[model samples]
Target: MKKPIKNLGKKLKPCPFCGRKMVFHKEIRINKYGKQVTYQYYLHEDYDIYHDESCILDEIDMPFTIGAGDANPDTGYIGEYAEDWNRREG
Candidate 1:
């Protein structure tokens, strides 16, 4: 199982449509060049509160700086992406 990454002191705003809290999800992958790429974004799972089982929203992919091997992966992009998404009016 993949563990969700921490928000690094950044907090995602509530969902605009359902007012449910958003969760941060991160994925780390190794490219062909042997660099670690970190992808961080936010997701709002409406199913938890509404029980509709069909609504889901997510922020666009945010890529982090490439890192050597898997050590000290760069996830600083997550904070910037979260800040921008949280300010959305809709």
Candidate 2:
């Protein structure tokens, strides 16, 4: 199986919009059938971003927030998610 996330681990930059620090997160999810599990890793600000409608989610509790989600661990597969976030023009 492919890696779930990839970050060059190059130093992370502060958020340009808020000038605040960023945080990383990991999440595991199972499809509706509850037979498979998937992983996600990403970065986000230190505050609540969005709320999910429980009725629609079925059972998963993935939150929607700022930052990027890397489903693949390859350096570019999504690990670049951080690289892209770090590239903020601020």
The global C-alpha lDDT for each of the candidates, from Candidate 1 onward, is 0.46, 0.44
For residues 1-90, write the lDDT of model 1, one tens digit per residue.
145444532355565644756555557789899999775545553223334432433212222121222222264444555566557886
The TM-score values for the models, in the order shown, are 0.49, 0.46
lDDT of 2 by residue, 1-90 (tens): 233222422245654544544444455567898866645544334334353422222232343233444434454343555667667676
**What CA RMSD would candidate 2 show?**
8.6
Task: Give candidate 2 regions above 4 Å deviation.
Answer: 1-10, 39-43, 49-78, 88-90
**What total of clashing residue pairs does each candidate reach?**
0, 5
RMSD of each: 7.3, 8.6
